[model samples]
Target: MKQQVRELFPTPLWVLDIPPSDAAPFNAKLRDEIEKIISPRPNVPSGSNWQTPHDLHTRPAFADFTKLVEISARSVAQFLNVERYPMMITGCWANINPPSAYHPTHNHPNNYLSGVYYVAVPEAGPDLIFQDPRPSLIMPWTGKLSPLTANASAEQAVPGRMIIFPSWLRHHVPSNEGTSERISISFNLMFRNFAETAASPRWKATAGQE
Candidate 1:
């Protein structure tokens, strides 16, 4: 899976081509609904800010979305030998970049997993950059290659594709250099049902998270 560079990072990262058969009409309807919510918030950055859609959890389209993440998580969790599988929908935020707008490099705080479903990816802008998290953990003695600073290795933004990875992974999108808009939705997730499973216990805070 590693190509063009040494394995510079750990943690699972996946670019899934979600079937997206019903996505055209679904995307159309989704845009309409999102517009309604957004018309009121004219100052909001659709590409950067996450505005939760109405009935996102109960809506059929969103249910389908949830199913996709769930199936993916179950497969990965079991493969990784995780304890519980109560993935929650932290929130779903849509992004529509008009010209030069782009999201900054950031990781979801206080979450377990994060995902993005791309609805539209116009040419010439916004590449999701995955950087080496441990730039300082390098061998002091130089051998074959000069160590590079935490650098972006690749950029991905294709329609009907879903990218899921651990929430803590630091990722960013380069500023949109293209003329058209970019559309996508980001989400956060965490396990919910642990006590029932009895395999592992969830972390509990005593008066404080620290």
Candidate 2:
């Protein structure tokens, strides 16, 4: 694969609140399922990598959750003026109270769009950190210089808040802090292989890209 780059790229960050009427029922359903799994979580070694497939939409109730995301995603695509539904949900799953250093900084792999919906965010630890997507650090090209905080920012996540961005963007969550656990569902979005249309490393300008 070859690398490509271009100017005038757009990145859009979206925050959504989960409708209580819809989210409540789902939460109840999920809690029930969690108990049924018959799995013990505390036994998981600290700082070890462990995931719960139960958080994925594998359950029947997940159809509602997926539908909710689809509806919201299409709306975002329209607002950004991207190809309507050009993206598809390839995989989704929920994570547990990850130990210290629970998540490492990384980018979504082999997907066009990616997002995270906060279900339960602890008061401390694991704040979403969004990094500068551009690789080069040279500044002043735009005739402006950024200070230290310019490299990244810790995103404040609230319930019903959903963040979406190009899949390649690099982001991560630090370890959880509060007594309560932190949980969020993540999703991947893919479009028709754009290789036939894309000619550069830059994302093709489309709706909702901004």
Candidate 3:
């Protein structure tokens, strides 16, 4: 008799790395804009700090950043083979985590996709961790296992790297041990129907036809 192993129920996560030359300028601009716009506060329940308004993508100072996000999002849609319909960013914000700061586990509500782009990551910075979505799998497990059976997985934070994952996935950032702050920009994206637009003729032609 012959047996084979099959994998099922795979989750998708996308990571994009921006070159240092491009990322450096953007990082400097972002830091300056963040400093001018708002001061850090205890917005999140955990130890981290969150920027207010959640519409940073719409600001003039973030035009280039927004373009980067749009391009990245389109790439993700293409990878998922959903490029027919349009997609738009619903919200965007920044997180500044200082030494010993951490973010509690949470999921983005009412959003289809969520992502984070690291602007600055110090040495020994905290890692982004995702928890297993299946609760039953961990109920009766006691032995050690590989990623397929693990309860959680961690990804190191790297400057200029962007990570995208399902909005429903629960994730958290561990406490930062580095001396400097770990800065990142996070955003949510959702699919938009072409029929909703009245200004585009192309949309009118395809609207209600899909």
Winning model by TM-score: 3
Q: What is candidate 1's lDDT per residue for 1-210, written digit by digit as tens?
A: 866866554566877775568667666666676676567655755444344562355566567666776777677667667745566666767776666676777898877778887767778746687766664565454454332633345647777777888888898877667767677777777777645664465777788557
Candidate 1 global CA lDDT score:
0.68
- lDDT (0 to 1) per candidate: 0.68, 0.69, 0.84
lDDT of 3 at 56: 92
Per-candidate RMSD vs. true structure?
7.1, 8.9, 5.7
Task: Write the residue-wise lDDT of candidate 2 on 1-210 in tens digits.
Answer: 999876466566777777777766666665455445525665767764445663465566568778877877787778878664376687877766654536778888988778887766666756788888767675544454343326676778665667877788788777776667676778887766456545346657888776
Better of 2 and 3 by TM-score: 3
How far off is residue 22 in model 1, in Å?
4.8
Model 1, runs deviating above 4 Å: 1-9, 20-23, 44-55, 58-61, 137-150, 194-210
